[model samples]
Target: MNVSVSRNSSHSEPRSLLAGVLAVLVHLIFVAMLIFGLNWKDHPPEGMVVDIWTELPQPTREPVKTVPSKQEPKPVQEPVKPKTEPPKPEPPQSELPPEPVKSEPPKPAAPQKAVTTPPVKKPDIALKQKPEPIKEEKPDLQEQKKKEQEKVKEQEKLKELEKQKELEKKKELEKQKELEKKKALEKQKELEKQKELDKQKELEKQKELQKQKEKEQAIQRQREQEAKAQREAEAQRAAQQAAARNLVTNEVSKYKALILAKIRSRIVMPPDLPGNPVAEFNVTLLPGGDILDVRLSKSSGHAAFDSAVERAIFLSKPLPLPPDPALFGEFRNLNIKVHYRE
Candidate 1:
């Protein structure tokens, strides 16, 4: 039960604190609203009237002194009333003037009480006091009017000052708003510029990639053209080489036939040559196709036919050769075969 009570109290404490905070907030909001909503100049404040009384009237002393002085004059006049029985009615009328005489009576009453005060002196002094109060009251009223006017002028000056301050505050707030707007516009412009720069960079990258691709394609085409040119040149060179070799072989064969025909034409056959026996010869020649040396490598099995072939070759001194000097190597050494025909 104690714990539950404590919990309840704690909860109540927080709720009270929250309520207090809300109340304070509400009060602050109300004050702020009043500050903004109320106009100072519309309701002019009342002018303060300050009384600066230089001299205060002795009304208390006047009342006290006048009462006793008027009563004392009555006692003195009552005795005089019997002394002057013929002027008894005049004495009561004389007492009426003493009421205003109280202004100066207090100053001379103690010394002049036994010496009967003059009747003419009381009426003159009383008349002078009445005019003096009237004169003092007139100046007091004028001074109060002046003070009120001055206070009003001061209030107007304060109101003007407050108005000027409010105008300045409004101008400052407008300037701040304009500055904030300028800053926001500049930030937005910067963001747009950044976006443009990013776009330009992307375009440049794409262009660079395109250029690289074009260069690669051009390079591949050039390489293909170069390879085709190389292959054609190789085929033409092989064909030319083969044609040159065949031409050299044909020239060599023609020269060999000429040489053998010349030698055979010069041969002198022996009589009764038996059944066409064959003979072979080994010959060495010079660059000019001159027979340098000749040897019989095979006999015809007839000594006379072999002797005839050997003699025929020596008689044919320089053998026939190809016109081209490059073909001389083929005729540098020669092997010849002959047949003896009857």
Candidate 2:
């Protein structure tokens, strides 16, 4: 159980750990929900009421004054003039016959007395009674035409001013609409920029998380490989130790036979050797199978034969040793006996 736990812990990924944590949290939330009931109903929104009351204006009352009473006019009394007595009737004179007068001869009559007559003076009343000059029809008509032209010019000027004002108002409205459109476009662009920025941030975060996960997995794999290699090394070391402890003599003999065969193949013997003789040699070897020394322990009493054996040993250079380093002690100073037969 403990080994299984350790193995699971070593191989578990972050995703699995997070899932387990989430599962626990979900269970806890479920239990909490069961213990405490939820209140899901929403409260109703409050309403506002507005009342409008308007009062009617009162009528104004004027002050009343008493009027004076009218009086009846009195009748006028005219003064009476005394009536004058009629003038007395004039007396009538009786008519007489006309008398005939005789003609007088060439008598100069005396100048009649000059009668005195009052001088009559004419009244001189000064009054300005000059006759008014007659007005010309042509000049009056021209003046009327000038006044009509001035009225027409004033009406045209008023119309032009109204047109200019209308045009200005239209231009102002167009400018306002354009400004609103520009502001809307700017707001949209800003929103798009913000959205792009958020997307970029999210992508970067995901990339960082992926990279971290990969790094962790790589580290885990490295640790597993290292552990496996260590285990293998330990097992190999133990096997080697066991094999060294149990050294087989037959295995040693096989190595010795291989060494002898190698040396014999390189030996150059002389034909004049008398009888078949056996030569014995003690060879000192290193753990790596390199010969340190070769000394003649027993000889066939032939110098040439001894010399040939020495030369053969020298030519062999590095001798064959046991494969196991622990068994190297057996071949450190190996003794070999060789026989040459004709």
For each of the candidates, the C-alpha root-mean-square deviation to the true structure, in angstroms, is 50.8, 50.9
Expressed as tens digits, the lDDT of each residue in 182-259 for candidate 1 is 457556655655665565566556645654555555556666777888888888889888888889888888877888
Off by over 4 Å in 1: 1-186
Instruction: Estimate, for each residue in 1-342, the C-alpha lDDT of model 2 and write its tens digit.
Output: 999999988985669878999999999999898766543323454564545523211111111111101111111111111111111110110111111100111121111111111111111111111111212345565456544644564465456546555644654565455446645755665565566556556654664565455555655666677789999999998898778655556678888898998888878987777779888999999878788889999997887888888889889878887777767888888898878862
Model 1 error, position 128 (Å): 44
Q: List the residue pairs that clash in candidate 2.
A: none
Q: Over 4 Å off in model 2, which ranges?
A: 1-147, 229-250, 253-328, 332-342
TM-score of every candidate relative to the true structure: 0.47, 0.32
Checking candidate 1 for backbone clashes, the offending pairs are: none
How displaced is residue 115 in candidate 1, in Å?
82
